[model samples]
Target: MATPSARASCPLLLLPSPPPACPSILATKRTQRRRRILSCRAAVRFDRRDVLAGLTGVAAGELGAHPGLAAAEDASVVSCPRGETVTDKLLACQEAGQKPCPPTPAATAAAVDFTPPTSPMRVRQPAHLADAETVKKYRQALAAMRALPDSDPRSFASQAAIHQAYCDGHYRYGGPAAASKDDAPFDVHFSWIFAPWHRMYIYFYERILGGLIGDDAFALPYWNWDAPAGMAMPAIFKDAGSPLYDANRDPAHLGAYVNLDILNTGDTVIPFDPQAVQNNQVVQNNLCTLYVQMMRNKKAQDFLGDKFCAEYPSTVSSGTSGSLESMAHTSVHIWAGDPGSSTVGNDGQEHTGADMGFLGTAGRDPVFYSHHANVDRLWHLWATKLGRSNFDDPEWLDTSFVFYDEKPQLVRVRVRDVLDAAALRYSYDDREPLRWMDARPTPLLPKGTAAATTRRSLLRGAAPAPAFPLTLTPGQSVEVPSVPMPPRAQKTPAAGGGTQPDTVLVFDRIEFEPGRSGKFDVVINVPPEQAAAAGPRYSEYAGSFATLPRGGNRSGETAVVALVLPLDEVLADIGVGDEDGAVNVVIVPRTQGIKIIRPPRIEIRER
Candidate 1:
């Protein structure tokens, strides 16, 4: 039998060949702006079942009359927590003659009773590498949790309800208006709380599972989608008789290569041939995306997301999604979810997404936990492997939320407690390589343009950048003409020589159709003609903002959110000097119908 690391190592996943980048941006050909630049099909020839072995108890009979794990919630009893969401909603209530929600508790009220454990750590193995026994243990734990009645806090359904409540706030005043996740008990998605909140959510979940199965050492296996062999939905979760399976996923996507950067093209773009030479770009493209996201955005604000204290969840959020939440994290959610199926939402109307896609019901799927485990593991890697430190803000460090522990007692945990996973007595198996580390993609020059193209002439003679209220052309890459870049400010050396402030591409607001998931890339200084064809494994690529479509049948709704991309690294690589007066901002939409209804500006943020 092969070791865990040995099982993960495969010779076929490497790139065939690729090259070049410039200080002057280059882009690839874009015949169809709406079509995917490169959709990947990464396949492992071995039978995955041969890799996954198990022993398990018979799955308990289905509960709640629903065919699968609905873990449904009642819309009436949900309340929006105060001091945790946007101030706009509160003002609206005051204007409407309604009293505001109560004030948020101060930092003193936050839980400080907890301390890191002194016990040895339990390691979470990657899903594809774990032996059959480990997989079986995971299933048996879920089966035990699933058997409990919804009334029990530790029951599977109740756990889902807790996640939905904290995900965002939804409500009704007993009127004809429909309920939406516009406000929140706690808005965890776009804020700095994202990683820590999810870590606690899953920590309690794992503890309960361990308690149920009489094994304190039991740790959840991550989906490990970052690695090629583990890209598809894990085989264990697909079994019909297992507690892990959910019927709401895309049937066509079962056992297929994961699409790391999918457009709203639906199932139209998932390639069936993993060996096809054309599909190789996607595998490489996603790896580079990881590199760009983790390496490019070194600041706590860019990587962890904006500070989201007292903000509500609506189409327009005060804070923006961070590098981790918006890019591949969101893409995986939209990819794994079944958009084709319509199920009843809290509003009692039919809506899209189940299990993995939407925020409200994602926790109902067993795969959601495993998926988040990988996300948490990535955060761990970002801090430990990359040597990045979190924010020094007292608010972020002291932020706390409540959860039910394995002992069935409601416990409050602080963000400070979860920063060290080892202190919490758990760690991820680092044996599998971080393959994306090597994905420093070379740039592609625009067609008809020679490598000898004069950089100074293009930099100095470029047309003035187009102004705001610029209506973007649908299904086309929109390039704002060269905009002036403020020269770099002199740096005062900080202690230990930490990261300097970042140069960024900041958008004031991006208005788009709500309730639909989409993607658009921000390629700094890339020629518009080549932006689309120049896949992520290229130097011009900066980052992307992806949506995790909301539930509900509501259509014709629009959402306005802000976006930011780090440009210091890409510009420096292309040889764009700090003294360079301007840079081109290209908007490459991966899906049609997306519109940028506002202007974008370039600025520098000091952390």
Candidate 2:
């Protein structure tokens, strides 16, 4: 792996060091006095429930008041492009005769003895393995959630809103942008925050479902799309009369068995014959993809993602996403949502997909939770079975997010508190050992002398090149000059004597317009025609950059995103040597009609 210096650098690295000594007494007094004044004002606004909460020995002061209150009521609110309050937006929708917005519940004191479930429940199994009784209970719980009024935080609408608030960039808190204007949207994807953020999200969501059904042991069943037996949409969720079923999903995908490998290419309708040789081969490919994403990716940055700090602009992502987040997480979402539908509604207003495809409406579908449950399971496996560790950066540990607890009370949680799944009182049911570990494909390599020549050539050409940031217009291609191999990679031996050293192409500081549904494909040293036609073969294709329709900077500022593509594998597949040379990189538009505003910079690194 590349050293810290070799890794892409960002301004966020200059985070505040240790603080200085104590300030003057007068300054301290002024600070304390200001706190007292604010405390008094907050106390005056508190409802009777706040007093009762304090009386229970859990001081209300310890729980910070709603962070959005001040911004929600500011005089500048009228100038806000969107409605000042969430309620105002809801009212506007109602006035316009659009779909009625879910109501927000009144704040109330949490139950005095309320606590999350502490006893362990047997880990949930793939939906296919669930018994009839278990399926019935799951269906009943979902029905209850749908029956709830929109106002209740545990209600299906409210639960989905929480996810939209975080992922769609609607939620704001006190930050650099908050004082003069609204803060940038808080997003959990495309950075180191992905794993831990989703873990906590599903944790509270599970608790809410259990509370509604009064089943503390209730566990979310996983969509085991990795296995051929569990490849079809679970029968429980497909029942037409069930609350778990959503009408907006792809009609053809309902009963069809999924081909996880072909999800990205929009060819998910593979015939469901378990005995077919082609079906078995696809299953093996899926397992191999899993092993590469989970086990082969050993570095923290390559697995969890890049470093994210408080200083990093909310509009821009500070790190590259891991393979799991990019491939497994994103592909499943696209496959599940209606593929032919445009994001723009008939009224010309943008709306989220009502199925698993779009980010804003993903949580609204009952199956999203179960899909994420399996994603969370993969993280657990990475930590336990693969021996991968979470990032130790203090900034990562200290960063926190707020969620509504089972009491429907907003609670703050930090990343440090959720490293263990058992602490949350749930686990997955035992499954067969990883069969992919023994069935991996053999490494491809050159002859012995040729391997040494490639390594020596790479080392001789290892001069650091100046960074280049290219702007790509639609149908335009830019070539990166002087791509260099890290010196450390030359000393590292290939899996086989002739195998290529692991290398990656890093796209840093990618910025573009928010809410645009465009994607750009990266091609390496190939003609435009070949690059455009590149399929799953590593030879001509690198990865593509996909953008979420929501979650752009509301202030109209650009948001930067990052991606990492395996370069050595691409080179090896094409019989190209990584000798110190200037390689041409072609950036082509994958989705036409959506223009590129600001393109990303590219660099190559040792993985």
lDDT for each of the candidates?
0.57, 0.51
Once fitted onto the true fold, the runs of candidate 2 whose alpha carbons sit more than 4 angstroms away are 1-117, 176-182, 257-268, 275-285, 309-319, 340-348, 432-482, 489-503, 516-529, 532-542, 551-558, 566-589, 593-607
Residue-wise lDDT of candidate 2 within 398-505, one digit each (tens)?
Answer: 455555666566555656656667766788875745664544333222323323433343334422322334454554444332233332234356565642334555
User: Lowest summed-lDDT stretch of 10 residues in model 1?
Assistant: 7-16
Q: Candidate 2, after superposition: displacement of residue 60 in Å? A: 66
Q: Taking the tens digit of each residue's C-alpha lDDT, what string does model 1 give over 1-607?
A: 1111110000000000111211101112213222111000101011112111100111112111211111111111111121122211121111111111111223113323555555457789988788787898989999999998665667787777555544423311111111232221224565566777788888888888888998888889999888766777888888898999998797778867777776522344444453452337557767887887777777666777765533233222324567877877887887788877765543244557676777667878888899989988887778778877776555556555555666665565667667777778898887767888888867665421321232343433444444444455535777764444545553334678855755677664566543456678777666677777655677777778777655322334344556777777776666666444455677877764455544454555555
Q: After superposition, which runs of candidate 1 have C-alpha atoms over 4 Å from their true positions?
A: 1-120, 171-186, 264-279, 311-318, 346-349, 446-467, 470-474, 489-499, 551-559, 592-597
Q: Rate residue 550 of model 1 by lDDT.
A: 53
TM-score computed on alpha carbons, candidate 2? 0.68
